[model samples]
Target: MTVLFSNSRNAQRYRAAFFLSLPALIGLFLFHYWPIADTVRLSFTDYKVFTGEFTFTGLKNYDLALKDPLLLLSLKNTAVFFLIKVPLQMALGLMLAMLVAKPGRDSTLLRTLVLFPAVTSMVVASIVWGMMFHSDIGIVNSLLESLGLPQQGFLRDKHQALPVLAAITIWKDVGLSMIFYLAGLLAIPGEYYEAARIDGAGRWQLFRNITLPLLNRTHVFVLVTSTIAAFKIFVPVEVLTDGGPSNATRVIVHYIFHLAFRFNRFSYATALSVILAVLLIAISVFQLRITRDEDDD
Candidate 1:
């Protein structure tokens, strides 16, 4: 009798716990899962958001998206941004991490200052950077003119727009990478550094052999995340360039925004979004596989 009563109490406790979590589970299904399912469904149809009318379009949207010259240009621009932004951000972040790795008052202060840009809102940063990059009445151009160099049209010039936007992104985001690298550096055992120092290993040799090798996982994480962030880049392009100067800075996400809201091509926008989702998933899986293989070795 006593054992049966205990079992009954335990069952009641479990039921209560599940009931307690039911609201969150329902919220997740309604907000997250349902939206994803709806997006996938809408991608296959000619959905008009304004009229709430859609026809079964099969692969028509995807076909048009593939052949769209603007999309092709956006893809190329996205690749270019990814290639340039990722390396520079990682390098700069690694450098800053190393500089602030040692714990001290000065190091703490420097780390705070370095990470300031990261905690700032991206939209605010983009707006601020937009003002800074202005040809006239902007600090950047003012400095150039002060040095006897002619003021140049930065975002207005097709050739310079993408590169300028990339630089702004790098500056705003590098601090996040720095924090990750700093954490990786801190987690390394002090004994390794002590042993290397006792053996008269130079700083560069110690870092190249010990620090860099140990940071392989951190490097992989930063690389993958930075690449994903670069692909989804929108604010800087939207606020600063609006994908202008002949679509020079029109990244994939920016192009999707232009298609969906600006032009009201809901189905086509969803198709492009599906493509982006697949691309990110593939990149993430490939990176994880590489990291796992390295670990196995």
Candidate 2:
């Protein structure tokens, strides 16, 4: 009788779990997977919004995307943005996380304040940053004037625009990354630190030997996701700068939008998007492999 009742309970639990997950599975199929499949199908054809018709083009879109000079320039810009921004953001985030994760008074308030920007909408943040970075009569220039420095165009100049956008991206995203690292730091066992202290481990030794090894997984996660986010940055460029000053700040996604909406090159834009998707997948897979190997070591 006992064994029979146990089997009945197990079956009921399984049924409940299936029912609970059914809504999410259906939503994913309807939303994400369906749209992706449609995009892939459209990419192979001559699809335009105005015409409302699509015909097979047999890799013509991909061929055109590869040949486009704007697409190539956008790809280079995105690569440079990612390479410069991700490492700097991750370093700043890790430092902030360490500072706030310590067992001390006021830590909670500090952490909450740090995370405020991350929760704000990207469009709103971009607008605010745009105002702050205005070329003439802006707050930044006003301050520079008071300090006897020349007024500089933060977002209007070709040379300064990309770096300004990169700086804004880092400021807005670093808080969330800090929160992630903070949580990872908190979850680390106190016993490790205790053991290290007993062995007369200095602060540098504690971080190098104990903290880093355990935080390896978080480091990998932050680096991969932040790199991908830097590549996909569109809102700041679109709202704050609009890839301004002769395309100096034109990232890949902005270029893709221009191709699809502005130029009516839907199929070519899809091809560029497909390339970006593949690149992100390759990076994610490489990171996973590296993390697995490190774990084994």
Candidate 3:
């Protein structure tokens, strides 16, 4: 009789929970899953630009993508951008988090300053940074001249353009990363540090062993999100360079956008989108698996 009553209560609670979450579930299907399914479907169909028709072409788009030189170049550039942005962003974010982890007025001010750029519009930020890095009239060049250094063709130089874009984005996005790290830092118990000090553990030892190890989940979450953000780098490239200076910063998303909108090759662009989605999923799964394994060990 008791078991039956318990089961009945559990079922009622589940039904209540489901009813509460029903709207979100419906939104998830309509907005996220439905678009994903349509994108996948479109990937296999060839869209006629002029006629507004989609004819099923099976795997032809995928096969052509394999032989596309521009796609390969974009992928390589995107990888380079990722390498530059993710490492610096992670390091700088962690440093900032550590700096402001303690509760104080100074920490509060510092947090506000750090997050200022994040709240600022990305387009406005991109434009302002682009002007600042201008070779001739920018403040950066003016300072360089005053210091007896040559002006750099920042956004205009093919080799430097991608890195400049990465730097701009890192500045804009690092605040969010810092917040994640700050949360991780605060969640760490004070007792851990006290015990470490009791055992003759120095600051470096505590950070290396206790702090780092305990923040493993935070690291995984931040890393995965940052990696995806890095991979989808687009706005800075679009607003500032538009993949100029010999296509130095022609990252994947920008390329796909140009293909669909500029060139009107919608089908091929959808195929690239599918590829990007799969790549992101695989990378995220791999990161989670690695973190889980480390936890197990």
Best by TM-score: 1
- Clash pairs, candidate 3, are none
| Candidate 1: segments with Cα more than 4 A from true spot | 1-5
Please state every model's RMSD to the true fold in angstroms: 2.2, 2.7, 3.0
- Weakest ten-residue segment in model 2 by summed lDDT: 1-10
Instruction: Say which prediction, candidate 2 or candidate 3, comes out ahead on lDDT.
Output: 3
Q: Is candidate 1 or candidate 2 better by lDDT?
A: 1
Cα lDDT tens digits for candidate 3, 1-297: 556668779889899999999999999999999998999999999999889899999999999999999999999999999999998998899999999998899999999999999999999889999999999889999999999998899999999999999999999999999999999999999999999899999999999989889988888988999999999999888998998889899999999999999999999999999999999899899989988999999
lDDT of each: 0.91, 0.87, 0.94
Best candidate, lDDT: 3
C-alpha positional error of residue 251 in candidate 2 after TM-score superposition, expressed in Å: 0.8
Instruction: Estimate the TM-score for candidate 3.
Output: 0.91
Q: Model 2 misses residue 61 by how many Å?
A: 0.8
Q: 158-177, model 1: which lDDT tens digit per residue?
A: 88888888889998999899
Clashing pairs in 1: none
Of candidate 3, the 10-residue stretch with the lowest lDDT total is 1-10
Task: Report the C-alpha lDDT of model 2 over 154-199, residue by residue, as the tens digit.
Answer: 8999888888888888989999889888888988999999999999
Order of all candidates by lDDT, from best down to worst? Answer: 3, 1, 2
